[model samples]
Structures are given as structure tokens and as C-alpha cells.
Target: MFLKRITLLRENIPSMKKYPFYIPSIQNLEEIDINNKVTFFVGENGSGKSTLLEAIADKCGFNTAGGGRNNFYDVHAAESSLGNYIRLSWLPKVTNGFFLRAESFYHFASHIDTVGAAHAYGGRSLHEQSHGESFLSLFLNRFKGKAIYLLDEPEAALSPARQLTFLKIIHDLASEGDAQFIIATHSPILLGYPNADILSFDDGQISKIDYEMTDHYQITKYFLQQREKFLDELLNDE
Candidate 1:
């Protein structure tokens, strides 16, 4: 229960909020509860899923770009101002955790090399491995239970098989180790994490929805079932 809930202070902004605020979904958001042990943020691009994850990471004392608090290599400060206005209720003590942004993982890996902490991640340089391999290595070697993890599109480099493996890692951490996860993703496979919270950020709002109701599931299901039919329509370029 280290990171319990989050609420937005819409009126507390001293000046105009920028990138995230400009996005319609985030603009109107007021509050979102993180009561569930595993919470997932699902939405289309620019729908505020990644933005919210970054803000949460910032508020939790992790790098807005990604990695744990100790890993700080702020290249350009590209994160938005949404973090300052976010209010989180937490338990007095939070177990150690990590914030992993797939996009900036390369930079974090470089920092690991600079600090000579490769042993903690996998006993080798992350750069030495392929993209997906590095990610799996990080989670497998690190990530003990009872910590809060924030991941933004972590499936970016993983294949379908790896996504399933990642999902198992998440489940093990939560069920076996008491770890909590907050993730933003587009993968239907990851979204099907056995009763995890699915918050949809579309149509200028964020609301909890059932697993089967998600567009990701429906569309993926439809496409898989009717790929040939869809190819007939999708490739019907007239």
C-alpha cells in the first residue's frame, strides 16, 4: 500500500499546463484510485496513458524519463509539468522500486555501465543483449516483491512470447512477492493479467472497464478470427 491513490489538482496550476494538459483526456481527469495491486493504463497514442505514468514516476521520486531514483541522467527534461499537480496518498513506508520507460532504457543502461552496477541487472551490460532480452534480464534479475513498479509501454521490445513471460513476472511479483505494478500499455496480452484494473483513456476521459470490453481485445480478437476477411477489406485499395 505504499502508493495508494492519485488525484489531480486541476485548479492548483499556477500557470497553463503544457503537453499533457493539452491532451483532452488528461485535461478533464480529476482522480484515479490505485487500490488494486496491479493497475493498467490502456489507451491510444496521446491519450495520456504514458503521460500519466511519467507523472506518477516523477511524483514517486523516480526519474521522469525512467529508471530508479539513483539513476539520474536527465538529457533534456522532456517530461511535462503534470507531476507537480498530482496528489498521491501513500503508506509511511514504501519498499524499493523502479520506474522503467522502454524508450529511454538505453540511456539508463549506459548509466548502469558508468556506475558498474551491471551485476544487479544481469551481471552483464544491457547493451550487449538485444532489446527484448535486456528488458527480460532487468525484470528477471531485479524486481523483488513488495515494491511499486511503474512501466511505460514495456512491451515495446518484447515479442508475443515474451509479453506472456512478462505478464507471468508481474503476477509472480504481486502474488508471491506482494509487489504492486502500475503500467501503461497497448498489448492485449499484458492487459489480460487476471483481474487487473484496466483504465481506458479515450474520448477525453478515463474510466475503468472490463477486460473483454476493451477495444484492444475486441479488435485483436476480430482481426485474428477474420484476418483473411480483413485483408480483403484492408488491402482493397481502390
Candidate 2:
């Protein structure tokens, strides 16, 4: 199962003119391949990474609730004008997958008992666990084989050490060919998966980039280089 291409067609989008509706246009759309076990989307805030993932999931008929066939009203509200293109495309469809939004897992966990139990080791809720432990548990226990998992900002709750743990889990998933992941994240560690395609969305377009060339990698390098100076400045300011 692979995603050959995804496209966006015209639809009514928000407008500030006389009418509140305007047609959204997507030209020279980005083409992403699921050839690799992991594909990452990296971009600044509001660059449409989440929108793209939702659109792809919508195109594939995955429930927005992150599980089996159960739709919510918000799913309708989340619909994109790009649905027209998704409707007309010939992408290999997906079934049995989870779209884990790191921020929303707290709410999501409340709904599933097994997930709740996993998060709550020995009757302790995920809240009782350190943020990193909770995140690792979610990644390790929830992701099974051969499913397309979509993750957004997974590193938000993880420390550098936990990020390494995530990398190991991802590597194991790939080796087993039981999972294909599309992750939108900022952690350099998560983006460091060998041979994974890194697509950068910037200035209204998406382009393939090398891992070493990523902003996350460069930013992390810069900080590590000037850690003492940064720490001094912060301490002095306080």
C-alpha cells in the first residue's frame, strides 16, 4: 500500500470580500511517496502541515477520531476545500491506522479503556507518569504493524532521551514493514530516521530537503554550540 499522489481541487474557502466564500486554488501540488517507512513534514506554524495530513486522511477515508469508522461533527468542520482533488485522485486507500495528535491524546485517552490502562501503568493515569514516559508508552503500545500512522508534534512532550526512544520504536516498525508513518514534527531526533524523506513546507510550497539541511538540525547545532552563552544570558536575565 502506497500513496502515489495527492491533489487539491477548487473549493469555497474563506474570503474577506463581499461574500465570505472564495475558491481556493492549489497548483503544482506537492507529490509525496510512501516508499520509505517514514516520511516527515517539517514547517513553521500555519504552513498547513496538519491540513495536509487531514486532507490525506480524508482522502483515504480514515475516521478523524483516530480509530475505526465513527465520524464526528467536527470532522465535517475540518473538511478542506481540497476535498475535490482528493475525491478524484487514485491513491491507495488506508484502513486500520491512527492519527495521534500529541496534544490531544489526553482527551483521546479518556475514551479508550485499553489505551487508558496502557497510559496508566498499574492503575495510575498517564498524568501520573512523566511526560516522556507517557509519550513512549503511547508510541510503543498503540502502533501495530502495517498501519499508516500520522503523528503531529510527537516530540512536544518528549525530552531528548525520549526522542531517542521514539527513533528506536520507529526503526523497529520500519524493519517489520508493519507501519508507515507520516509525521509532522520539530524534533531533530525524530527527523533523523535514516533514508526517511523530509519535506519542508515553506513560503507556500513544499520541497524535499536533506536531514542535515533541516532547520531543526541547524537550530539544534547552533544552540549546542552556544549553550553556555544561552544559559548565561537566561540566568543573568532572571
Candidate 3:
């Protein structure tokens, strides 16, 4: 793996009662070892998975707003709050990589159009494509070489079928040993990648979890198998 581990610098923090530090998982974080080329970060909203991912992106010199080294642009409130408090350990560090934040992708697309770099993303403006198409276009065309990719909630725009397509893309990139991916996602499909490491940010801690053990897997499975019963329980007031 390119990024071997991430160490949280608790000593550098000015206060543990602050914004990022107050988040349970991050508050308790010590260190995380990245043991696979494809590592998935799974957690509930506000659980600090994305916060930590953004920090890694910041440390990697990528635009925390969402982009690779050369794609620089400004987005308000895009700065990573926790970035300064973590250290990444890379084995034979790589400079080539991309950080994709779904929320700020529109701004990245606008910047690409302004810079006339649409050719790299399928020869058409990303804005012209549907949201899912645009995401896939970037994944299919711009990802290559020995690089690390940090993606936050990539499944937001993808349909279930498209999500399967993304799995193939990830497999192709990772199998060749030229690319490593650290993705924060809620998609149970993406979490099923063979031999990938799944980290759960739950119960105020970060720990490894099995695929079937994930709530995403169990819930999705149960819902599919017992949709009526599941909805009855969920919708029942009593």
C-alpha cells in the first residue's frame, strides 16, 4: 500500500473540546494502518470518517476542496479543519493523486471548464453530463498511473447499476498495483470488494469490520429480503 498508516497528533491539538476533536471517532483516534490497496471508510453521518479523509487529502498536498495537485481553485468552507493534526506515513511516497469531495465537485468542474481542461475528462464539459455520468467520466478517464485517490461519498450520484460499474473501475485500477484508493462510502456494494479492508467509525472508535458485519450489508440484505416487514416496523408508530 502507498499510505501505510495515519497517525493522529493529539499533542498538537490546542483543545480536545473543539470542532473536529470533539467528534467521537476522531477524538479517540490514535493511529490507523492502511493494510490494503482498497480501503473503505464506513460510518454514520457526523461520525468523522469524511473529516479524517479530508485531513489525509490536505496532508497529501491535494486541494482539499476537491482535485489533484494541478487543479487548484477556491471554495468557501472547504478547508480541512482536522488536516493539521494528522501525519501520514507512506512507503515510497507518491506525489500523484486526487481527492474527490462530492459536495465541491461542481466547483471543480467549473474550474476545469475555465481552464479548458475538459479533454482530460472525456472531451466534454462535466456540466453537460448527468451527475452519475460525470462522476464515471472522471473515474474512467482521469485515473491512472501510480497514484492514491481519496474519495468522499462517491456513491451519492451513482445508481445501483452504476455503482456496480464503479466497482469494476476500482478493481481494474487496484488490481494493476498502480493505484490505491481510500474511499468513504455508504454503498454496501462498494464495500464488497474482495479482500479490501473495511474500517468502521462507530461506537466512538475506528476499528476493522467484516463485510457481513457492516450495518450497510445486513440492513440492505434484510430490506431486500423482507421489504414489507421492514417497512411495517419502520413505519409503525406503535
Which one is best on lDDT?
3
Two-way TM-score contest, 2 vs 3, winner = 3
- Give candidates' CA RMSD values in order: 1.5, 4.8, 0.8
* Residue 210 local lDDT, model 3: 99
lDDT values of the candidates?
0.86, 0.66, 0.94
Give the worst 10-residue stretch by lDDT in candidate 1: 13-22
Choose 1 or 2, whichever is better by lDDT. Answer: 1
Ranking by lDDT: 3, 1, 2
lDDT of 3 at 79: 89
lDDT of 3: 0.94
lDDT comparing candidate 1 with the true structure: 0.86
Which candidate tops TM-score?
3
- The Cα error of candidate 1 at residue 111, in Å, is 0.7
TM-score of each: 0.95, 0.76, 0.98
Q: Give the clashing pairs for model 1.
A: none
